[model samples]
Target: MSKVILITGASRGFGKIWAEAFLKRGDRVVATGRNIEALQGLSDQFGDQVLPVQLDVNDRQACVEAVNRAKEHFGRIDVLINNAGYGLFGAVEETSEQEARSQMETNFFGVLWVTQAVLPIMRAQKAGHIIQVSSYLGLIAAPVLGIYNASKFAVEGLTETLALEVKAFGINVSLVEPNGYATDWSGESAFQAKPMEIYGPVKDAFQKAVSVPGFFGQPAATAEAIIKLVDAPHPPLRLLLGSFAYPSVRKVYEERLASFEEWKAVSEAAHGSN
Candidate 1:
């Protein structure tokens, strides 16, 4: 089926791959980014099938207007990919409030704005899918990527609740939890915090881990997995996109389960046998 798809952060990385894939498959794509020129190639290649819109997801009004423009041009959007966020690499204490808030604005609130903008249209159409391009950090926290983890965790919570709330309206919400992928995410797309003496070693370890050869996977595979999820008759609420995601997230959940089990008696006793 030829569907109308809107993707934020489509200038590069996974978003660009998704846009091209969808266009090649004959779907109408509304590719949005901060740089209009970066997306001109898509428009030139796909012609009317691609609408390259310059967008800043942090602006809620722009998000709403972008949705309106897409709906006007393509009639109705069948899918929306919230993929506009970037990484904030810092320890919790090293990250200033302003930086943390900016991270949340882009990764969490921006997703909320986009979803809110699309809900009415999907409800009226009686069908749609919202895919959040979250990270594995959403499910498991790391030492230095505290701010990024928190933002993605918020996204996870919002997306899960949204899935339950909108299912009755025939809208499916899915979180694409990808592990480290070979993208600009760790370089130019990422934000590094001001170094603190206390966090130097921790930061070094984090950087070392990231710089390890072959640690990151490919973005094309992640995009392909997302396409499979979207094509499903009933897509999952959480789709782990990378090979490492399942085991990594599983370990986190298992550790959490152990902790809860160890505290089960105390937890139950706190209820006072009521």
Candidate 2:
């Protein structure tokens, strides 16, 4: 029997590719995204096996309904891929509070609601995979990208806690930190701020960093990696994609390790049990 997987942000990018690839391999795909028209087109192309659900994850009720529809369509959802998110570029200080909150709603709380809605069914089944699509930014803080980085960082922590909570029930969770992938990635990045004027030269430099699009690997690579992740018996908790993520992650580790060492004596003194 072919497994059924539900992926969000499935109208484009790696999310779309993953759905298509899974369908090609005989799995049922419940693909959801904010673009109803694009998702409808995918449904038309793939027919019944690909279920394109139009959803705005920021709308809490909409997420619950999407999951219900997935349950109705597939009877059971074997995998849940929280692939929906957009990048908001700006320094933490420069970004508006409203914009930051909205981003968190879509990227973090949206995932939270959907996962909670699906937990009952997954727990009943006693086996499932939860793939949280985070970014390399999840592990590091960039000068001009702190707001975006903050949400992904929260995702990293959330996934870790949820994994521990659900492990005994046989649910597997994997965090995918892909540096960048060739897609409609940049054009779709949400831009919210007064102007780059306040940021000055660094803003221009940051724009330059994000301007080059096709340099990243094809979405196909990420799709393939996600598909493999879903099938693994004991998948790793973290999987870094592309060449860029490895060094980025290593640097984050070193920075964090140094910070920990610097505070070790302070931490030890605070430990009441010690």
**RMSD values, in order shown:** 1.1, 2.2
Tens-place lDDT per residue, model 2, 23-103, is 888899999988778887667877899888888888888888999999998999999999898877777778888988988
lDDT of 1 at 93: 88
User: Against the unseen true structure, what C-alpha lDDT does each candidate score?
Assistant: 0.92, 0.85
For model 1, the run of ten residues with the poorest summed lDDT? 218-227
Q: Which stretches of candidate 1 lie over 4 Å from their true place?
A: none
> Model 2: clashing residue pairs?
none
Best by lDDT: 1
lDDT for each residue of candidate 1 in 4-56, tens digit (9 for 90 to 100) = 99999999999999999999989999999999999999988999999999999
Q: What is the clash count for each candidate, in the order shown?
A: 0, 0
State, as a TM-score between 0 and 1, how close model 1 is to the true structure: 0.97
RMSD of 1: 1.1
